[model samples]
Target: MKRLKEDNLKHFFAEETLKKYSVVFIIILAVMLICELFIFNFKWVNSAFDKKVDAEMTLSGINESGTDLKFTSDSATIEYKNLNEELKYLYFKPGSNKGGVADITLSAVDEANSSYFSAPSRTVLTDVKSSEYIRLRFSGEVKDFKITVNGMNGKTISKDNIGLNVRVPLMFSWIRFLLLSLTLMLLYVLRPKSFVYNYKTDLSKNWQRIVTLALVAIQIITFWNMIHWNTGVLEWHKSYEHHRQYYSLIDAIKEAHLYLDFEPSSALKNMDNPYDFRERYAQNVAFKWDHAYYDGKYYVYFGAAPAILLYLPYNLITGNDLPNYIAVFIFGIMIMIGILLLLWEIIKKWFRNTPFALYLLLSVVFGAAACLAYAVQKPDFYLVPSLGAIMFGLFGLAFWLSAERKNEDGTTSLISWRLAVGSACVAIIAGCRPQLLIVTVFGIILFWNSVFKERTLFSKKSLKQTVAVCLPFVIVGAAVMWYNYARFGSPFDFGANYNLTTNDMTKRGFVWGRTGLGIFTYLLQPFNMDAVFPFIHDFNAATVYQGLTLTEMLMGGVLWLYPILVIGLYGAFKKNSFSDRRSYRFVYFSVIFAVILAILDAQMAGLLTRYFTDFVWIAFIGTIITAFAYYEMLRDNEHSRRKFAGIILTFSVITLVLCFLSIFAHTEDSIMKANPTLYFTVQHLIAFWM
Candidate 1:
């Protein structure tokens, strides 16, 4: 009977493992809940456990106006002339400016000594009209100290209406609990011995379609929420009005013209140098900003492809200007699909054994690594061209790869329609963002056998295939060139040189000196992190290069931000890893061309984070190719395969988190400014302790 009991116990532990481990997971979560409530957020626990108490001390200050102390300027200092007490919390009433929420930080010095300073506490004045008092946690034994408040944003903060040792409301942070639970659950599921490691590729076509559809659904929900800010409807405001350049171009197209409808002001046209920003400002001229002013006509200097393809058709059909957000949403969705399809096609061709989890992870990395989220976040005409180019680039490459099929003899044959479709998509990049035309050059290498080795100037089959590839380029190329020639008098000139904004682009020739700065800033710079909620901070673009270089705040380098991209170096450097030599060349050239484009963007346009869209996807896709290569290499060893997949999953999750945080960071047109309540709500949700 004892032996039978032991056998039954063994069966329960081994056969019902998930049931047993689930209980363990629940126990761990319960422990975490207790720790969070009792230890991490004990202040709230204490508040709940005891009745509320009034302030033990009150502080007052008088400004130069002899009024109750208010932050009249961008900054203010409040000094307690005499005070000696153990302070735990500070409170003050903040009045909003009605424009936007202000991020106010208070730094206090204890005992009038800088060395004995208390940690700074930041509070966002989210409610513009409410008379509620905001609280900041302060803990120190203090006497004769000063508190400095910064980032008033023109709002008045009452300093005299301040209280020390104030009791905060009972705060059971549900958000903190939810985040902890999710973290724990995710870690538990991805544990080394979990079934996640045992997952294998589902090779059925239906499974492939399901995976693609799942990604599409995720993209749909994500982009919808991002574009609408969780509101069911998109808000229309003055910010959209300023960036309706696409509508301007569409109106010009409706009138059978190439230039925009915004006529150049006579004061601006009469000036000898219309591109001179200071001269225009000094004269108070009313010319279109960022528009190409050549021969007194204002041209939308941004690529005309978005207008010609998307906005123009929508305007004609709907009899209204197409919103840039809609266009970005469409382009953004297609870009994600193209990324997944391209990756899927490559996986089908070469790395068929790649795990579904790895495939999902790399797909996400490539999609997010492209930084199309910036375009989605801003959703303006400026990013339309870049977004479209990446979409077309991915689709074109995917189609080109899909054209090849295996034969009965274990060789490959090319499909004509796929080649034509791929070439046409490749040619469209010229119309979208001409700088990204560099991607199309990969075609020659991709079709090395058909172009160089076969050398077909005649013969029926070869001629038909040749026409299949070249005809689309000819048609699209001719149309794009004609459009350019009609606008700029030269097929090659996209009219960016004549832009009447910022520096004179016509003379902003390439400087070799800027290349090093561009490479480091674009591809090598490490993330500047902080202890704050959104831990990642913008990379400072300050450099020693003494020149007029147009630089913008960067998030971080592509590699440092997405560490999985380092695997791309393995593919580029390793020659024997790939079974197909052409695939090897593709990876090698992707890295090479990405570097070249980075240098070009740095030299021509300077270092802007938006310009990362030009090459990051290329590097990311190359990395995906190599990551799968490494995964397939470990196919015989399940342990190594799981380890490799875990690493990819880990990096991918980190990258996704960083990408989400970036949208809320203090940057131009950030969500904090667009939707302050939502921003502060999420901020307080995740950072409840703060």
Candidate 2:
């Protein structure tokens, strides 16, 4: 009986082992399939497919009087239909010249049988001279004639140019699908068992609940602020009319629509300058209160779908005057919330025993500076989407890192669900900005590595579950793509209007060139840029100057956690254990990705540190790792740990003092030049700091 019990136990253990490692096999297979299909283009079959549609139009005329007729060909075509009256009208492309004339020869057999207008030929005066439409007149007598219209041949309109590349060989697409499926399957089969065990931990459960509530509150607050503050207050409204000095909100909306919808034509004269089109579209639009909602084209629009949806109800309730300040406020609040959540997740996962109070204070000050700087200066809410995405990624990393390990048993272990929620947030981030798709891909890879490479969680079922977790992001991403296609004709196209208002093409070069310069200037200017309190406004012959200090850049003050973050990176590189290294690798990848993005988007005027805020979060992660390293080092020496802690505190205080001093210097200068009262208040603050 004892021998039989041992055999049963062994069988149970074997089954459990299979379940644990199945996801790893699944992922490996999936990866192999992907590599073979898309990258190698392994072909299984060859076939040809073709599809075509033909359209025809016919026009007939029956008249008794012999009439001199004219036929004009406008770029725009109209579908033909039969009319019973002698007089008929058909819409055609607007003519090129103001009063262009076309002469049509009308021939018909005596007033008896059907008068044939067989393909009436006329020299249609083209409107190649002006941007404005030219009306063409065509006069004809009643006669029987048939006009056959052929296929259209003209410049394609923006709407008609939808380039859906469905023509990629079906075999290739099938192979890709197959490979993706297989890789996903393998990933599932070979995934680590620890993931499930860690997920079962109470730490994971509690944090998940806490983070969810925080996220919900943040989302609600963001929505409220976007609708109530930005959209409600800063929106342009009509208060004056006779003097034509004040612009109407309706005009602003119209201008936005025109700017978004306008298409340039080769045949239109005096339309050579694209800026003219933009300028004409923006004319008569005025600022509301002290803030202008429109960027001469679109309203200072926040492009995230959730935010937009939230604002819709409010817009309906209040009518269309959406204040820009609402967006600004929401953006600010969201940034703060994201940063707090990130810091909280990091501390909870890695530094739970550390002083939460100190961490909170440091997080608030640092996050506020970074977020507020971006908000007040740039005022572009479109960036919120990207920011939201990075926040989600951070959440995912936190969860993956915080999962608990399980010993040899059939029971489950626990992992941080706060981290899972964070991963889920990546989808929301991607929705806000499509470019973050790169980050999303990197995130998926990191997650896969965590589950398979580190924890050895593998099974078909686990792989499917992983894909399911990722589905929301994919669906949202596809929706964004479709939206882009609908608006821009191509999913990848950002539309033709790539102009920046302040930075002219000559000074900044083309957009890409300017962005390159911006990146270069950002890293280089820290050494030389002047500092001013409240405001740092100086413009060189070409560049705008803002004051930033070197010490702040190096030590990061309340942001001192950045230096510590490097320690985490060091752990990632040196530690052989999956748990110790995976999070660091993920953060490292994120930082690199963020840097690349910044470089790609270098067209902005300055290389503001705010642009790299996501990277700063990665630095925070590094700091956590560094703190862990410090803890480990002090494990045998209590006195040293105490000394190290004191040193860190001192360093933080000194950094803060220096930052304040820098701010004070700038405030004093500004007050001397502009406002004495404000200057005195700043001076008093400086004195207090001193």
Candidate 3:
């Protein structure tokens, strides 16, 4: 019952002019580049402080002058080991000028000779509440120092911490300018040629352009959120605290000189392998987080695609590897692109009658927001599989879906470049998550006709299609298998045996007994909610069966979070409603694949939220396809049934908002714990109006 007419997205362009926008973007980028060059000449933009408040931390005294950070008071009088050298620095948590103004005044006290050295007071403003240390940078260190907080209000503002941090302004440095230039260049290439001009690229499509623009906007926000409060733990923390293993391996590749040997790596711990682990006399000891140690060489147990594709090559070209979070963030954006393309392809095939908004809705839900924010939560080694699967799986599937598209002359094009790319994507999908091979069922069903067209095993055109499609798989698969052999001495071994998991994977086997219970928990597990801001909580450990299988904390089952996914099985429930035999067959196969993946994960990988990434996408894709079919049924039949569509739209909007908020409020670990300042800032920002 929705209007058939579509909105022209031209109005959404920058001031209705693409050229104007490009020119302005170029100007800004040029300015940034010039500024970076000037910085290279001079030390900084300003001879004095840059007026940028990097951190806003509460005050605390250093217990032993450097290690444990327990901030205490706004003012501190401390004695240092060296009178003129050690105690000459102070820290700041910028003031939130809403109520009053404050500045941290430091006066170094020379206890032996009644002399003091203090830097000019720097004004402060509220910033993201992470601590930053400001060194006095005086000629010599002072052992005795006194910090005075000057506030306009007599109210004792709590903001103080003893200095153990000496921060540089390199976080947002010249490197950002180079990155900015790259971003601008890509934008230029992708910019709309002319809003009104129809071109070979699909950029001419009115709605697709809007969707791409929305993607660009979303990327800005996601990238901002990734590094907004990067606490620097990922820099060089020695332990397995977070994504240290990921970057540590990258650092090893860069400096260790050993192909994959981890030595001379960036770390707070000793990196020199004086023990000569990779040389003559060595031990077979490996670092934690699945770094396999075999014959004095350390091989990363995770997928080599990320390192080979992103880290190693990038480090070689740029002389350093980027933060793993940045890679995950970019991959997350690609996942969105893939999902968007997939949904668009689906709309082209089945839901051409539906509105463009519907396509975008399904795309955003399944592509970006599905799985309760697991993909973008934190860019650690834990995310490598989820990110890889999302990028390769969705993109591969999207490309496959675009295999057949209608032409302008009412004809169809069966031969699409996407098919070959999709074929290769499916092959890589197994490397990302070996279990995702189940999705290949959908692809097989998709090309069922093409496979059947040729009566012979090999035909001229069919052979070409097969070669184009299967070549990437053959090459990538061989390389992956060879990589395994090079590392673990077996082509099939991915070194999961040497992993530092709770239980030894080499010793672990399938827990078939847990399948029934795991299926129930994975599909029907109830979501826990509370009155707290982040209402969702972890699955009750009691609900899990008593077994030896491993599991991670889960928010809820797929069905509990998104119940509408059950519509994927609409064919079974409302038989004969689907007139399109091919579409019905696709849905049938998708359901089977979903079931297979769920069983595999529940029985094999264990019941974990992250594991849901394996099969939950099936529900997402199937739900959209089924919804469109149902939409057609309503449109062709009783118009009164249209209210159901309206209800779904209204409910979907509400649900998405709640889901977004729930991710923010997820219990135990979330934005609330990861960055308390961001969480409080959001709460306060919301509270100001609410």
Candidate 4:
């Protein structure tokens, strides 16, 4: 009888393990299938004008077993021979920049009938440099596909050329899906436990584990995708194609040509030359977008970090440059992760016993709204400041939080070095985007009591420690000032005045009259949704945002998208809701700055959606903290069903809206449109709209 009971227990254990495994396995399997079948898209480039080609398609030969197709070619003999049993789409991506001279007369000697039914194949492929999609479709049976290029000048096309990638129909290529599937599958089988975070730790550790596991997985996917994606040259040429000074800076660096005094310049028609007044002028030497023309050289007004960090290292390694789109993607993942980490710290600090699930949910909302919905769209010139600001601010805040960790005995250790490190991170705000320097105040809020002893203004030890924290910031600040001085001849002037943009920055200043409207547009403007794939359309609002700032059609203000923010404002004034006064003050401090910074951005930067990324994070974090506080009240209430339900329903609605908002964030201008197959596939799923 005892032996039979033991056997029964063993069976129970086996069944439970299978159930756990099955849940995870199903999720993994769904992801694998979706990646393989659903999320497939690619971007192709021409040898000329690859920078602007928006639409791309699949590699076509991937099947159930595996992808059996591959490319092997040298500079001279370009070949994509069919090794698969089926004939796949012949996808050739070209150029990285908008303009390049590429006239390739290719002799396409098809082995089989390279025709879609009876329709004859397009014999001549001309204007390969154009940004618009020109189809080179082939549907019939084809075996070997070889193209011997009639080279322009002396450079023959490489069979395995750069900037050209194989695209599938969705957000990823088939080859990419196959590769990711195999890698993830291998990982699952080998280290399955690590993929799922252990939730048995303290509330803090639980959130940490969840974030860490997620970070590893995303970094792996993002890194793989970054390398595999057909990103054009990530260099001065591609990145600074419009902003010419960056390109010229790299040229000046490589050539060691330091010229300031007497170079002949082209002035704008008959206007005085901005660079050298001695020659013919082109009115806008800065040419396009927002660039600074100084001393006969074009300078990017964005930041120096992109050049120093991304472009330089990429050049050293790949013999090519890194594009802002690819750079933003890589940094986007980091910034997203960093933002989550920052949120976790704030949540833990605000409410020590906050549930891990709630933390995760809040992080999800923040990630979906900030990272995926808004920031991911502007992967071009905007990436440098937007993503950079997010990264510098969030991680800087996170590092500052780590400077003090409470022990089990309730004693806090002051790690002065971390404070310095944190300051160092924030200091680079000078280079990337200084607007986020408001976040640095959180550092002071975190470190203030320590910096000042009880009943005294300041302490000697605290003062010394403050110096340590301020040291890195001072050094980095000096470096940025020096960089500016060397380029624009003024430490204080970071070239904003010199920008040739939609408005003249030299004449642009804070308009107190328009700021109220700017604030209205920043967070309160309504979103417009149309009957389209990307359902969210432009906001047709009568705005007082008459100031000079370039922005897409408003997709509603931040408040319209996330209404739960009111909970925080309500919680702030509630007596006895917060556990402690210090944390409560900190929350308000962050909230005040967040809103103030939004106003500052509206005043300085104007009414752009991506600038919302600068401050919306504070609103998201504040809401989460307040919601936690509000929940504590409901937990202790006599009859809390209606209250709890109301809270849950409100949160539930926000979450539900966010899920759709993240995907259908922008119609017509949606990244989903990049993958026509995936876009249409998902579009077809919703025939009710049709």
In order of listing, the candidates' clash counts read 0, 84, 16, 30
Where model 3 places Cα greater than 4 Å from the true spot, the runs are: 1-204, 219-223, 226-287, 293-297, 405-413, 453-461, 569-572, 637-641, 667-669, 684-690
TM-score of each: 0.86, 0.48, 0.64, 0.64
Off by over 4 Å in 2: 1-270, 273-302, 306-310, 320-322, 347-353, 373-424, 435-442, 450-459, 500-520, 527-579, 603-614, 632-635, 654-680, 687-690
Q: Residue 113's C-alpha lDDT in candidate 3?
A: 37
How many times do residue backbones clash in model 3? 16
- Taking the tens digit of each residue's C-alpha lDDT, what string does model 2 give over 275-349? 333443455222221111122333222234434443444555776534444444555565556655555555554
Worst 10 residues of 3 by lDDT: 192-201
- Provide the overall lDDT of each model, using Cα atoms, as 2-decimal numbers: 0.71, 0.39, 0.56, 0.54
RMSD of 2: 29.4
User: How many angstroms is residue 194 displaced in model 2 relative to the true structure, after the best TM-score fit?
Assistant: 37
Tens-digit lDDT track for model 4 on 1-690?
A: 999999986775455365655665667767966644443322221212222222221322211123122222212333445522233333433322322232232223244455212222221122221112223344343344444322223322232332222232233334445655665553443231221222311433565676557854765475444332222223333445463333344545556542222233344423453423222223334233455666555566677666666666776678665665666666677766776677666655665544444555556566655644454444555656666767777788877877777779865656677777778878877778777777777766666666554311135646656676878888988988887888888888887667655555565677777667767777777667566545666554465454455455566777766666666666567647677666565557656766787788866666666676777776665666676665555544525623543564456456546545544455434544343333333443332112
lDDT of 1: 0.71
| Best model number under lDDT | 1
